[model samples]
Target: MTKTLQKTTALSTKNGKKSPTDKNLSARAAAAQIILQVLDHGKSLSALLPEIQPRMKPQDLPLLQEICFGVCRVLPRLEWIIRLLVDKPLKGKTRIVHCLLLVGLYQILYTRIPPHAAINEAVNAARQLKSDNFRGLLNGVLRRFLRERESVLATVDKHWQTNHPEWLVNKLKKTYPNWRDIIDANNQKPPMWLRVNRNHSSAENYRQRLAENGITAFPAENPHALRLESPVSVSQLPHFAEGWATVQDVHAQWSAILLEPQNGELILDACAAPGGKTTHILEQAPQAKVVALDVEENRLKRITENLARLNQQAVVICGDATRPETWLPQAAQQITGNKSAVKFDRILLDAPCSATGVIRRHPDIKWLRREQDIAPLVEIQHQILTALWQTLKPNGILLYATCSVLPDENGRQIARFLAEHSDAQLEPLPFPAPQAIGHQFLPAENGGDGFYYAKLRKIA
Candidate 1:
C-alpha cells in the first residue's frame, strides 16, 4: 500500500517569517528533502538525485548520495532505532526533521563521519528546515544513541535481522531456499560492471587501456564484461566519449548474446530505452537491421545518443510494445519495404518488472515498490509477450528478460506463456537455473545484478 506523506509549507523562521532560500540549504538538509520525497512521496532516488546533485558542491555530491542511498538501504533499522529514541512520530511539517534525524543516525552508525559533526550538522539542518523546536530533540536523540550505541545495536540484531520491508522478506522466503543470501546482497553496495563495446575494442584491449589509465578492472565470465576494482567517473575511462565501453551489468550484457543477432536479421528491442541491450545487438551483428522501440519519447534521446557515440545505427521509434499495430506497419515498411508484413527475426522483450533483483544498485526500489505492484506488472508482461509474439517470424527467437527474481515475473510468467501458445517452445538458456523454465541470477557477493532470461522459439 502506498503511504502519502502529508504536504507541508516551505521553510520558515520560528517567528513565522520566510526562512533563507534553498541556496542556504546544507547537504544534510538537501538529503533530508530527498529522503522525504522517496519514503513518503514514493519518488525514485534515480530521478531525484539528478535533479538535486547539480545544485550541490562537487565535493558534497558524494556525501549527498551516500546519505540518501545509505538511509534507504538500512531504512528499517533506522526506523526501528527512531522508535526507541523518539517519544512520538514526527508528522506533517516536522517530518522533514524526522528524515534529518534518520540522516544523522545513519551517518553516526554507518559512515566515518564523527558523531559530533554528524549531530551538529543534523541539528543545524533542523534549524534550516525552520524546526527550531526540534533542534534540542535531534541533538539529544543522536547523543543518546551514541551513548547507548552497543546496546541499541545489539537489540536491533535480535529484533530486525533483515533491513527490508516485512512483506518483501516474506515473499523472498517463499521464493528461494537461499533467501538470506539474497537479502544480504541487497544490503551491500553493488560493484560496478562494464561491457566493452566489441565494435570499438575487445575486453582484453579495454582492460589494458584501463590499466594504462591507472584503473584496475578484471574480466568476468562474459567475454566483454570487466568488473572494476573500484568505480571511477566515466570521464576517467579511456575514450569514454567515443564509447569504447559502457557501464552495464554483467547480466544485462547477456540479452544480446541470448538473442544471437545474425547478419541481415531484423531485430526488435521492445521497451528499449537508453538502448543498452539494443546497442549490444548492433555491436554483435552490425549488419542486422535493428528497430529500437520505447514508449517514452523523452528517453528515446538516450538511445540515439548511445548509438551516435558508438557510431552505430538503429531505427529508433517511439511506440507502445503492447500495441504494436499502431506503429509496426510503418516501421516494417522502413526496414523491409513492406507495409503489410511486420515480422522480426529476433525480439528482445526487456519487460517492465518490480526490479526486486537489482535493489542493491537502486536501494530506493525497496521502499518505493509495493507487493501489489507485481500482479499488474505480470499482466503487462503478458500483454507485451502476447502482442510481440505475433511480430516474431516463424522459427524466430524471442528472449524474455527482466531484472527481477520473482517467479511470477520470470519462470512462472514463461510457463504460462508456453501453456497458452502451442507454437511457442522454450529453448534452453546458456546459464544454469534451478527452475525448468528460465535461468534466475540472484545478486551475488561480487557479481551481476539479479536478472532472468527465458528464450522462446516460434514454431512454423
Candidate 2:
C-alpha cells in the first residue's frame, strides 16, 4: 500500500491545488512522520532527528519531539491499550495501521491537544500512510480508546508498574533493586543542558551572555551546566553563533571536570562520538594534547565538527577503542616513552552500553533494547577498558563512564576490572566527586540524567 501524506489542515500532491505539502505543517504531522519511521522503518529516533530536524520550524521542533517522544515514552502502555481493544494483532505492513492508532491514543491520552485535532491528524496520517482503507479500523480503535481512556489507563497503571520490556525490566529489578525511581525517571523527558565554556568565561558569565541573547536559564543543579528555562535553537543563543557554549548532559560533563586535565597533559577520549565529553575535556584544558577515538568513521564526524566549533585540535581517529594499536600515532608513542604507540597522561573511556539510564532522552530504548543486550554490553565495556588500561601512563587517570545505571555496568564492571587487574586501582575521586559507587548519580534530585562514573588510576 502506498503511504499517504494526508495531514491535518492540508492534503498532499494528489489533491494539491498549489503547494504539494503544507509550508507550515503542524507539529503533529512531523511527529507522526517520525513515529511512522521509528515504528514502520525501524530507525533510531535520536539519530534520525538530526537529519529530519532541518525541515522543521524552530517553534514546532519541541512539538514534533513531543509526538515521537510521547508515543515512545508510553509505547508499552500504548501497546497495552492497543491490545485491550484489538482482538488479533496486525502484523507486517498491516501493523503500521495499528501503529497509527497508537499515535491517536497517545495524543488523546497524553497531550493537551483537543480530541478533534488528535483524531483528525491521526486519521489523516493513516490516510497519508496509504492506510486510508484502514482509516475506519484506526478510527474505531482510537475512538474506543478515547472513550475508555480512564479505565484503560488506570488498569495499565494499577497492574503495569512499568512499560519496559519484560526481560529489561527484570534485569533492572535484579541489578538495581532500588531502581523503580530510576526506571520511572527514564520514562520522562531529559532537560536540555549546556556546559558553560569555563575557559572563556564562568557559567554566570554565560548566563548573562544567554540573557543578552534572549535565552533564559535557571541555575543548573549541576555545577558546570546551565539548564535552559526554555529550550531554544542555537541561532538564538548568545555567542552560540561564535561557539560560546555546547549542549552536553550535566552528568556526562562531570567526567572532564573530575579528570582535571591540566595543560601539557596528554589525554585520551575513547569511544568518543557525538563528542560531548571529548569537547568538555578540551573546553576545560585547552592546551592539553588530546586523542579522540571511535570505532565508526561516520560517528567521528560529530567529534570533528564539535572540535572545530570549540577551536580545539585533537588527533581524531576512526578506530575501535578496544584496539588502540590501529589508532595510536607516532608522536604519542615517544611522548609517553611507550613503544605501543600513543600512551596518555590520562584517558577517558566512555564505553557504550545499553544506555538504560538515558531512556527519557531516547525512549526508543524502551522498545529497541532488550534484557539480553546488557551482558554483551558488559563484555564490550570489559574488552574496551582492559584494552585501553595499558595505554595510560603510570599515574594516569582512566575514567570509566557510561550513561547506564546498572550495577553490572557501572559498579560491578569497575569491581570486576579491579579484581582482574592488580596494576589498576580504584582512585579516590577528586574533591567534587559524588559518594555513590565510584559515582552513581541517580535520576531524581540530581536535576540531571541517570549516569555512572568510576575513576581508576594506572599507578604512575
Candidate 3:
C-alpha cells in the first residue's frame, strides 16, 4: 500500500537557540519525511533535498542527508530487520514513524552515532510528528533491535543484505551472467571526479593548483579528467567560479572524446540539460556551433548558468526531441545562416533510460525504479534515436549513450536500430568496457559510472 507524508515539520525554537535535543529531533524528523516521500510518492531525493535541507539547522543538514541516503541504501535490510522485530506493521498516516525507526536503526548499525542517542532522538521524533502514541513503541523496538542486532543481521538473506530489489537482481543476472561484481559496485561509494575546463587550464595545471591547495587528485585516462582522493565542495577547488573545473564522472567525459568534435562544425547535444557534455564539446572545439536541447524548460536554466560560468556559448533550446521539427529548423538556421534545412556534423544522443548505472551516486533510484520502466524507456530512446538520425548529415557520426547497464537499452537497442536503418553503420568502440554489440561499462569499483556508448555513421 502506498502512503504519502507531508513535508518536514518545523523544529520548535527556544530562545533562538535550539538545544542539542531539538537539533537531533529536527534532523531525524526531516530525514523521516524525506524518506517517506521517496518511498511512498516516487519523489526523487535530488528534487526533495534542496527543498528540505534549507529548513534544517545548518549544522544538522549533513546528518539529515546521511540518514536519508543511508536509509534508502540499506532499506531492504532495514525492512527485514523491522519485520523480524516489530510484530505488527505501522500503517497509513502512522507509516512515517516506521521510517523514523529505519533511520534510527541505520545510525545504530552504520554510523558512529551513539546507540542511546540514536534511539532517544528517534523516539523523540515522534513528538515532533505528533504521533506520541508511537514513542514508547519506537523505544521498545529499537532497544530490542540493539540486543538482537548481530544475530538478526547474520541471518539476513545475502540478496536483501545488499539492499537491491529482487526484480533488479533478476534483471542484472539475466543481462550480466556474473552480476555480483555489478551489485558490489552499486553498493560501494562513488569517487569524486573533476573535469578541467581546457579553455582555462590543462589537467596538469589544475593538478598543480590542487596540490597547492592540499587536495590530492589523480589524472584519469582522459587528459581532461581527474579523480580526487576525497570529495570537497566546488568552492574548495581553485578557480571554481571562473569555471576552471567541473565535477563530471570519468565515464561521462568519454562522450565528448568519442564524438571527436571539430572546430567550426555544427553539433547538437540532444537531451542536454545541465549542459556538462554540451560545454565539454565546446571546450574541446571552441569554434563549434553547438545547440543544446532538452524537454524541460526549467532545467534549461542550469545549462545557461553553466555556459555563463564557463564563459562559453551554445544555442539552448527547450523542446521535445521526439518532435524535432519544432526546434531543428531553428538550429539549422543558426548554423547555416539561413532558414534552409541543414544537417549537423555531430549529434550526441544521451538518451534517457532506467539509469541503473549510477545507483551508487543516487541510491534512491534502486528503490524508485521498477522492472516495468525499462520497456517504456527503451521506446523513448528508440524514438529519440530515429528522430535525431534524420538531423545527422551524411558521413556525420551520432554517438548513442546511456547511463544504463541493461542490454535491451544498450546493445540490443542499437543492433535493432542498425538493422532498420539502411544508411546507418555501427563503428567499433575501443575501451576496456565489455562489449559484444556496443560498449557496456559496469559500475566501476573505483573509477567511473556504469555507461554505454555506441557510434553510428550515416553512410548514405
Model 3 ranges off by over 4 Å: 1-25, 157-160, 332-338, 432-435
Residue-pair clashes per prediction, in order, are 0, 9, 0
lDDT, candidate 1, equals 0.87
Which whole-number lDDT from 0 to 100 does residue 238 have in model 2? 73
lDDT of each: 0.87, 0.74, 0.85
> What is the TM-score of candidate 1?
0.93
For model 3, how does the per-residue alpha-carbon lDDT over 65-90 read when each residue is reduced to its tens digit? 88888888878888988999888898
Which pairs of residues have clashing backbones in candidate 2?
3-129, 4-128, 4-129, 4-130, 5-128, 6-128, 394-460, 395-459, 395-460
lDDT, candidate 2, at 58: 83
Question: Model 2 reaches what TM-score against the true structure?
Answer: 0.86
Task: Highest TM-score: give the candidate number.
Answer: 1
TM-score of each: 0.93, 0.86, 0.92
Select the stronger candidate by lDDT from 1 and 2.
1
Q: Which one wins by TM-score: 2 or 3?
A: 3
Please list the residue runs of candidate 1 whose C-alpha ends up more than 4 Å from where it truly belongs after superposition: 1-24, 336-340, 433-435
